[model samples]
Target: MSQHHISEVPVEQREIGMLAKHREHIIDQIDELVKRTKYLELLNECQRHGLLSPGMCQNIKEYTPGRRNENEEDLLLERHRQLFKKLTQRGPRAYETIISVLESLDCKEAANVLLSVDSGSFVSLREANKSRRPGMTVVDEGVTTEGLVLSKVSKESKYQYLNPNEPLVPYTKPVQNSKRIVKKSDKCHEDAVTGTYPMCSQYNRGVLFMVNIIDFPNPGVIRNGAFKDGEELIHLFREIGFTIFPYINLNKEQYMRILKELTSSQYVENTECFVMVLMTHGNRVNQIDRAEFHDGSIAMVQTEIIAHFQASNCRKLANKPKILMFPFCRGPEPDKGVETDGRSAASPKPTAQPKRNIPTLSDSLVCYASTEGFETLRDPDTGSWYIQKFCDVMAEYAHNTSFEDILKKTQSLVQNMRTATGHLQTGNYKNIGFNKKLYFNPGFYK
Candidate 1:
């Protein structure tokens, strides 16, 4: 793409035009030195009020004769310098005008220079410098003839007082560097998505609980790659707006106790949602078992786990969203080899299942790594296939997209990935028991 000269574009359209281009979007970033918008108006006011002499105004007007790119930038820098000088002198109605012009030009550095040299900060110093003792000379104290006061000099005898924060020199405008626009990673898209809704800073959003098991007493049952999965999930959830509570290497009894406490009214108060991330090893006995603690070997029922957080059981979370993610293997059966022709078949479109009339689990969304009796795939370098896809999809499209839509995309993406052994793996979303369609406020967070 060809680079456009700054002088060719109108001031207002500069940002918009740069954003419209696909390749040069980073050029729309705020410039260090902002060009003055009301240069003629300020010049006219200074000349009429005699704040600046006619000769000084004429010199400013004739600083640069041409509208070339280099010359225009140079003229803008000079105007900023003149404005800073006038601001120091405390000209009538000049502070408001200069501040407004700097804000309009998006000149943050120049604005800082103006605000740093505040009028109020100089009043005391100016008065002190003008007040001198009648008989106190440099030779009277242990001071030199160059007006350098000694440390023993009294506060009243000091000639000059300067605020260290304010500098006498004008701030030099920095040249714009070609900073590479950082794109979101393939495995995790943190801030890639853009939307119109403002981010709600009230922080009424809920809490997230990550239950990870990395160490097991039995050396044979080592969860090598599970720790990375939990770390990534914590970072991802926290970024989108969830207060994270990481529970690592907990036994069965401790897990239940924590869950019970979280479901209570005191813990769940003022929370909009709850997220439970479980990463551990499981067996055919229908329970997650990995570590051996003081309270025997860890073994907890999956059905009972979800049932404990039901609306009837946990009244505080009634009518609120509860997300449950399980990234561990459900069974020991790995995907076996299969021979087939290189032909693809069209899959049927997904349809929403009809709501049940009987009493059922409510206000909960549960996800599993694989279907029943199948083993899930995990990459040693990256995390599980299901979790990586789920996080990436949620990060990029969760702002405006529904939670169900994000899950559907994650499912399709995970299903298309093949394991290192040429085995296909798929994730299952079971027990989606919410009454209405659920959506996350990814647009708002802490």
Candidate 2:
């Protein structure tokens, strides 16, 4: 006879069962019609924000205890539990309302009830509480994924948190000035409806411009691993709704020209988001190296690249999410085999230039594979550790999780990975200035 061992159940699961059992008691506290209306409204809001699919909404609408099969009903309830969990994490007012309703019904384990519904939701709920407003009404910030703060004022009439001294720029659509001459080249990009390729297709959620530089003038610095990175990214981004545009082996002039052209492309105007992936050799000063087949190697400063997409420059893509992924060496220093014997001699550094501000360069994210003055590792078979973990985590959680949350998880995953030589790779994320929670609608391309 085979012996079966019964393991101890998790505290969260037990709590969930307890909450489910007392679901009726909580329901009794709220007016049935009002509760139903609120639930429906929440679902609609979720749908509008790309958090829930049409099929998910339909499933909720048709939910009945015995009408559907047992398994189907269980799945439906599980989805409901997920929704409740997400609300707790990202919806401050809804979570507060749920907790208040439970407490009013004399449920002492209100926190347990929330944990039971969604195990990983406790941290999110705690974070939400930190920024909760005084009133009960939802205050949509209109930018971030963490939905409106609770307030007495209605959402439309509610004032945003702004500095009293700085003059505010009202969010408005861009209009063409009659006196300004429109250049023929400025009217770029093929018509989406008539475009044949996926990169130019109207159905795509966004454009992914990948620049891969493999062969350098120096044999030691040749990026044999870059092609693999491109392949991996293409597969990953496609699943997440990006139309991939791979530009490989471009010299310095060609790469710069292409980037400048893309900034003014009509495609940027139509796309919901923009992604730029750079897989190349770079320096500590944030300059990417390019192979000049005829002349030699040249460097392109990272700021010059980013400036092309600035608000004053690329008006069409202003305020939209711009994600830049750089999987390259920030410096020549290796991670391992450093000499601890003696103090190193200090060297004179180059003088830095004065910085100019671009106010419109908000809503951008820059992901660096390694920090300044360090070298990141790459796998010949797979790809860079950061990119691989980033794609994996994004593929699994991008649909429901906020980009910030997803990136945090990816950072954690990257930090946990160790190389064969026992050297660990660490990545850096710079949130340029995104106010809204960025997300790709699940099954958008499908």
Candidate 3:
């Protein structure tokens, strides 16, 4: 062979005019093949052959073992022969006419003819080849046996075929991230105490209520001393101006009632934000006690109770910052401690069962004591790692920083503490994002 060095063309500016022209030509050929008159004639022929109207052909030309290299002309001719044989044997006038029409087109014209005819009918010729029978091949004039035409049918075309799901255009716009501003009417009160109140109300100056659900009925004298640490948390929130509501040994119904009242629009509307603290024994999915307990447990407050409140009454809080501090074990036991460690041994059974019906809140922050599939640890002397750090960070940062900033500080503190104590597994839960921005002043400065 003579040495033939072909010049490589830049794909971006390569000559596609020929391809475009060929495409247009093929399209025109298809247009002529699918003329209404031709379709009517085919339909008449099919009717004469005792066949119904000539419906759209789903798989006209397919690549097979022997037909892999077949061009449009060859395929069209093959289809004509197949249809003719079937029509003659079955007596479908429409099939006979369609075969005759298809036979008249050459390879270069066959694709356009079929496309135009189907385009006129309810069938879309541009739809994905997957929708057609397997082995079906779509080719342009220049498309070789190895080349394939990717067809995509529009919804409008599908609708013409009686597909209700298909539409001419997308009914919904693309979802885009947009900034949201959270509005509040309250101002921080100078008389409010520090370190106890949630920072959300400091900037907004709203009434705050802190509810602590402690399931401990009675701890041994030594354990009892440590359990009293939770009482300090209660006192802190109260001194900071929050109305303290402690639900001790509360059942499902009682918990629901309290949550209903707290989240009710009637009450929540008067406040700039809401804060809920759940301190109880929990497993991976449920909150349980020694005996039987509520299926959803503390989480029910958001999903079932709060959902009810928001849906029926408290639409105002729908967009407000609803903060939930969940300090509970979420999963199986932690690893055994080293001999050098002097901490108490792990309990035989989990302290509590998982809450089954916990609900998800749309516009809120859920601060878990531990990450998913991990257990939450309590100091017995300082409450839970999550709660202590959370309260401490809020008290330290509430006066000068935003709620978002406080969360960041809390997360850092928890990570540091976990690392320092050799409990690297005790890291903070993932940050719960919000759709809107929230700013808070803890009232420590004011």
lDDT of 2 by residue, 160-205 (tens): 2122223322112222221222111111123244231122223546
RMSD of each: 30.1, 24.9, 29.2
- The Cα RMSD in angstroms, rounded to one decimal, for candidate 1 relative to the true structure is 30.1
Better of 1 and 2 by TM-score: 1
Which window of ten consecutive residues has the lowest lDDT sum in model 2? 9-18
Query: Among these predicted structures, which one has the highest TM-score?
Result: 1
| Residue 289 displacement (Å), model 2 | 10
Instruction: Judging by TM-score, tell me the better candidate of 2 and 3.
Output: 2
Per-model lDDT: 0.48, 0.49, 0.38
Name the better of 1 and 2 by lDDT: 2
lDDT of 3 at 101: 41
Better of 1 and 3 by lDDT: 1
Candidate 2, residue 348: lDDT? 83
Write one digit per residue (lDDT tens) for candidate 3, span 73-109. Answer: 6565555443323222111112222333444433335
lDDT of 3: 0.38
lDDT of 1 by residue, 20-66 (tens): 12112112221332242345654554343323333234435545434
Model 1 bad stretches (over 4 Å): 1-201, 286-296, 337-360
